[model samples]
Target: MPTLQIREAIREAMREEMVRDDKVFLMGEEVGHYQGAYKCSQGLLEQFGEKRVVDTPITETGFAGVGIGAAMCGLRPIIEFMTFNFSAVAFDQILNNAAKIHHMTGGQFSVPIVFRGPNAAAHMLGSTHSQAFDSFYAHIPGLKVVSVATPYDAKGLLKSAIRDPNPVIFFESELMYSVRGEVPEEEYLIPIGEADIKRPGDDVTLLCWGQSVPTALAAAELAQEHSDLSAEVIDLRTLRPLDTEAIIASVKKTNRVVIAEHGWPYGGVGAELVDRIQRLAFDWLDAPVARVCYDDIPFAYAENLEHLSIPQPEDVHAALRQVAYRD
Candidate 1:
């Protein structure tokens, strides 16, 4: 095993995939010459050359459409958006073409593409750059949405996503790009849609993904320290093919759950998970599912206001205490 940051792990995945398959190439703003906006593609351009590691104009829609067309023509394209918030400009290509091509062609044509880049808020990037579109992308039928929290998961899931037959949305958190964790040196792939129990407990469940996973784990630690509550923490490695079974199982054992996300409260990923939990394991729940999420408002540019917008560990701690009847 080797320790690597999320960015390094992602770079390794792309590097390996591109070397393994000649058809696999990268195209996005600043990906080639700039070596990726976040340096995830460092040295890739020099190794793979200008042909494979391509840099496109700032137009997300234009490059995104080109990527889709390339994928349809049998090339595996990894389209980076710089940030997922910018991906909205490519919504037509992602939702209309990449998502529908396979089914529309009755499985004869497939969009073997991976759309990836930094996602969610990092520090005070402001409203335009801070939105989390995981829920939005996950809602689409043909897309596979993956949200990784660790270096290990980042590498494995990304490899799988690149090899997937359909379009996959790989959402990375800018805040987690520099976070270090142990990743296997040998090649590996973590199947999408599998959930990992980061911490096992009996009192309550904390369900989260991406940056929120760390927040939930911190909250779990605080819960144990302050209230002696054992909180089970589940990292949803994949969002779309949500591991509903894992969620139901955790809720059944803990008898309570608190869902946390860095997105808006209304119609967030937490809300959808709560609905499924209530429908599948209502009888096992001792309290209503609690959600720790962003306040329903446009993200503020001010530091203080930004801090208050997203849920914090303290908020998760409070939610955990309540769900555990320890508040």
Candidate 2:
């Protein structure tokens, strides 16, 4: 095993996939010459050439449509939006066209495409770029949504998404790109729709994904110092076709749960998890499922306010305490 930054793991996955499959090509704004807005695609143009690593105009809608069309014509296109906030501009192509084509055609056609970029609030980036939209995409029926937290999962899941026969939305948190983790040198693919129980516990279950996974783990570490409470943490690698079995099982064992996410409480991914758990494992639960999410208000540009808006370790700790104790 070797330690790799999240960004480096992503770059390696793309490079390995491109080398393994000729149909796998990358196209997006600044992907070629700019080496990706976040430099995740650095040196790809020189290795893959300009045709395979395309640099498109600033229009997200136009290039997204182009990527969809390319996929239909038998190419695996990885489209990178500079930021996921720009994905709204291309929503029609993603939601209607790419998501529907396979089912609409009755499995006659498949869209083997990946739309990836940094998602959620990062530092002082304003309200426009701060909102996390994994919930929005997860709402759609046809797209497979994934938000990866660790370098190992990031590399494995990205490779899996690229090879899957349907369109996938891969969200990487901007803040996690520099974080380092151990990644094996040999190739590996983590299957979609699987949940990883990062830490097993007996007192409460913390269901989370992406960046929030780390936050929950940190909170669990702090909680252990003062109390005998054990928090089971589940990292949902895939959002759609969510690993409900794993979540329900964890809830049944722990008898309490707290769902953590970076999005707002209403209509957020955490809400759906809580709903499913209530439906499937309500009798097993000892307390009402709790949620730790961002404040409903828009993300503030001020650093302190921004930190306040999103769920932090302390917030998760508080939610766990509330859920694990009864009156």
Cα RMSD, model 1: 0.7
lDDT score of residue 302 within candidate 2: 93
| TM-score, one value per model | 0.99, 0.98
Per-residue CA lDDT of candidate 2, range 1-327, in tens?
799999999999999999999999999889998888888999999999998999988899999999999999999999998889999999999999999999999988889999999998888998998989989999999999999999999999999999998999999989999999999999999998999999888899998898898999998886776666789889998998899888888888888998889898889998888889889998998899999999999888998999899899888888888997732
For all candidates, what are the clash counts?
Answer: 0, 0
lDDT of 2 at 279: 92
Clashing pairs in 1: none
Q: Estimate, for each residue in 1-327, the C-alpha lDDT of model 1 and write its tens digit.
A: 679999999999999999999999999999988888999999999999999999998999999999999999999999999999999999998999999999999998889999999889998988999999988998999999999999999999999999998899999999999999999889999999999999999999999999899999999999999989999999998998999999999888899999989888888888889899989998999999999999899999999999998889999999998887775
User: lDDT (CA) for every model shown?
Assistant: 0.93, 0.91
Best by lDDT: 1
Name the runs in model 2 displaced over 4 angstroms. none
Give Cα distance to truth, residue 269, candidate 2, Å.
1.0
